[model samples]
Target: MNTARLAADLVEELDEGGLRGSFLVRDLHTGREIGIDPDVLFPVASLIKVPLAAATAERIRLGELDGSAQLTVQPGRISTPGPTGLTRFRYPARIAVDDLLYLSMSISDGVAADALFGLTPPAEVNRLLRAWELHGITARHLLGALSDTPAERLPAEEGHLAHSLAISSGTSGRGHRIQQLDVARANTGSARAFVDLLQALWTTSKIDAVVQSRIRELMGTNLLRQRLAPDFTSDATTWFSKTGTLLNLRHEAGVVEHADGQAFAIAALTESRISAVHQPEAEVLMARVARVLRDHLRHG
Candidate 1:
């Protein structure tokens, strides 16, 4: 497989798309990174949940938290409308820690994330970030700006209270005269930092391998499935990845373990050309990289 040529081709396509910001692709097994922009910060979108899941697992390992433990979604647990907020539940739902993680990461469930955040504090999330050494560009830095006030606000669409706002409306509220918390850019991360976070998950024995496996399983629960998986699926390659999208961003990051035991970790973040719409162009960019990498290893 022509690895360098594939890498060059992907970069050429990204340049053609007019995508701004950083991108990084690394083979975890060989520790060889084959892409560019290793240290540029961009919005992480739902990709935030990947590290959040890891942080939650770390907490469980320290005996500070429990995955099987149950918690009820209360009024105070309501968050702003987003991919995973409670927009349709008639009654307070009861779920477990593992379920919350699954919902949060797999489905990008905002309600599940709020449920976890409700049980703990944003500070706790930050604590986990610090443990992972991901405190610099994490949600904790933006939580106060995004979800600072806990007034038990209702979902803007429905009558029930949902605390966090969705990306579309959240971005609109920025710099408005009204008193609203604008979180369109609530959480941000650099492409390099995100890959580093994944590196920690794949390489660190801090969290049990079994727990890491669970995290990967949940990441695969993406509903949109708009990332590298689609491009490489025809090859029968096993892909464990997570995807996040906003108005101007699309991100996917995960580890691919070949049947031959060759594993690679890749994280692609893009600010698309279309400024205000969710476009597949960013994901398409990611697919190109995935295709190049797959060919690189397949032919080699």
Candidate 2:
């Protein structure tokens, strides 16, 4: 199929799946790429952890922060996570920066991220990205700010009400009544922006080589795989990715390397229009769309 027809069909498929998304897949070697609205900015949710990890790694590389230095995390400092991590601890625990990076990136642990944020503020992370020549991503607040949304305030069964509010309360210009969903106010990035970061991490870039290597390793260890990982991971390939989900948003960005030395960096940032949160079909749609784009790029 032609690129135009393929893009049109992908957009229709996304809308049918109750998703409006920005997607981009670029060959790491040739730099050839394809996408749908890849430049449109969106609130990035937990995907911001990638840069957070990168910045923290940079600090450690520069000896400004000690990766081995242990920091104390008091019990109940953060909300208990859905799975398990620091928030479940009944007593104060001392963890090194290196281990915290694992929890934050690999397992999407907000408490660990907030701890790292305490060490390196959001503004510092933003400064590091800019200094490294990465653009279009803004880190404004720590991960704790994300937990304060309506989704947390509502009762268990009424959770969809928050998702309903998230769907209905949005402006044409991407503004939302919810601060976390608002691009100008929340931690945000575009599909293109994330692809650029992946490129930098996967290849030579302004980010220090040591820091980049560490960041890539953290991503390779990512445990949340139900999103795009299923489509990308294989015995013959490696998918190093990070997933972000907040309210109606779902995003994952990573580089997939094939056995024959070919690599593709892909970013899929999406928002759901459906009110109910448990949309496994939406996740499937995202993975299918992204894989189609990767297949197109690989063939042509």
**Counted clashes in each candidate structure:** 15, 0
Candidates' RMSD to native: 6.5, 1.3
lDDT of 2 by residue, 1-300 (tens): 999899999999999889999999999999999999999999998999999999999999889999999999765444423534775566888999999999999888887888999999999999989998999999998887777889878887898999999999999999999999998899999999999999999888898899888988999999999999999989999999999999899899999999999999999999999999688999999999999999999997
Q: Model 2 residue 290 lDDT? A: 98
| Residue 246 CA displacement from its true place in model 2, Å | 0.4
* Segments in model 2 whose C-alpha atoms lie over 4 Å from true places: 76-84
Q: Give the Cα error of residue 140 in candidate 2, in Å.
A: 0.2
Cα TM-score of candidate 2: 0.97
Q: Which window of 10 residues has the lowest lDDT sum in candidate 2?
A: 75-84
lDDT of each candidate versus the true structure: 0.60, 0.91
Per residue, candidate 1 scores C-alpha lDDT tens digits across 1-300 of 365665566678776875653566667766766555656555566677776777677677768888899988643243443444442354687888878887777667666766666655556766766765664455643222233322234334442112112222333323221122223335667666776777767776455686676676776565656677777453546677777765445777777767776667777776554433335666677677656654565445
